[model samples]
Target: MAVLTVNDLCKTFGAGTARSNRVLDHISFDVRGQTFVSVVGPSGCGKSTLLNIISGVETHTSGDVSVTSDEGRPARLGYVFQDPRLLPWRTVRKNMLYVQDKDDDQARRRVSTYLDMVGLGQHGDFFPGQLSGGMQQRVGIARAFAVEPDLLIMDEPFSHLDAITARGLRAQLQDIWAQSRKTVVFVTHDVVEAVELSDRIIVLQPGGRIFEDIPIDLPRPRRQSDPAVATLQAEVLARLEKMKAITPQAATAV
Candidate 1:
């Protein structure tokens, strides 16, 4: 069964007014468990708005989003934002544990496991300020996974890292996804990053609607230089450029 469904979603700000803005337009998509889906678009394309709506952080002006298999169960929703957003004073372990109220030994064990999984077990005692940008982001990932979330939402989580670090983390994230099989929705502006990490790529245009949905159909541990990845990235990039060309100059003309 599909884990999440977004049906004919629409969101507008300042409706029926001179200053109104239509952010999302009839967006629809579905996500299954253990699948990595990336949404890519221009800077002001409402990508983050769509993700916020899905996470229940923001409400859509119209249409509906529904999640199956998550009605009464405690679902872990991991969010890796553009910034690590770690607590400055708290040690990595403490910052991670802050989100979990459960005291069961099982819970503690899971926390430790995710810490090690993200390569932060040895640095759990260190403060966020002491770690490198990439390492702090790793801590953020560990904190998110500590809850064992049913869904993971990443909004350009590695945009701040250097290219080498971003590439390495991409591989590590793929490993984590393979091991945990959590439902993942990764939002990125980088086409290569989206191709490397996702099982499917959903391109969002100026509006929140999906412009293209393409399955990767490539083997795991995909390399950036792989012919298939390069070709597919080129294709997606072309689509993005075309989208920009077609978008109207203003809402008045639409």
Candidate 2:
């Protein structure tokens, strides 16, 4: 299992003087095992920064953050960004292999398995450019899971796709997550998407503080058409609206 802990975490883009901009402020939370957590907020609200800090792509100004695997080792991480981020010259299979610790047969098989999970089994030999935008994102998702990471970080992975494509990919992701059960921290502005995918939703207000940490008690394989899922999504969206109404800073920050 994977364990993640954050205590009084803070991040500032500039440390001193008049130009200093603090993005995250004393954020604290913990996630354990295979939970899927979504961080939702408006743009520039430090959603991506939080993920970057957790993934070590960015540094925090102060506070404690720890991620560990059940085996008492540093947890392996997987990340899927807004774009595919694939090398143009590489085949899908090669791109998947690029991040693997090993190129052995077992590792290769694992890569293939994940590709299949994302419905890209036969496209492994194709270059990223050969695929459509949605297909490329599918490859990105497949590549992330191929690594068998203890923690997976996704930053608006489906944001760039068309609505129909995004919906399809979301369903695919839910199916894959149900089977793989990887610990995931997904960042999104879409409350409906958050409700569908997360075991818990963490709402980040402007100025980088958490407004609410709401648990999603809904069942797996959630669909927008499902009444329970829709109800929860509406409730979350309503809360976000109310938050914006009450927090004058949140309105200005957006």
Reference-based TM-score of each model: 0.92, 0.97
The residue-by-residue lDDT of candidate 1 on 39-89, one tens digit each, is 877666788898999899998899998765656774557788889999998
| The best candidate in terms of lDDT | 2
Off by over 4 Å in 1: 70-74, 248-254
In TM-score terms, candidate 2 sits at 0.97
Measured by TM-score, the strongest candidate is 2
Candidate 2 lDDT score at position 142: 93
Q: Which lDDT tens digits does candidate 2 get at residues 1-254?
A: 33789899999987896889999999999998899999999888899899888999888999988898888776899999999999989999999999999999988999999999999999999999999999999999999999989899999999999999999999999999999999999999888899999999999998899999999999888998999998998889888888899777777543
RMSD of 1: 3.0
Cα-based lDDT at residue 21, candidate 1: 91
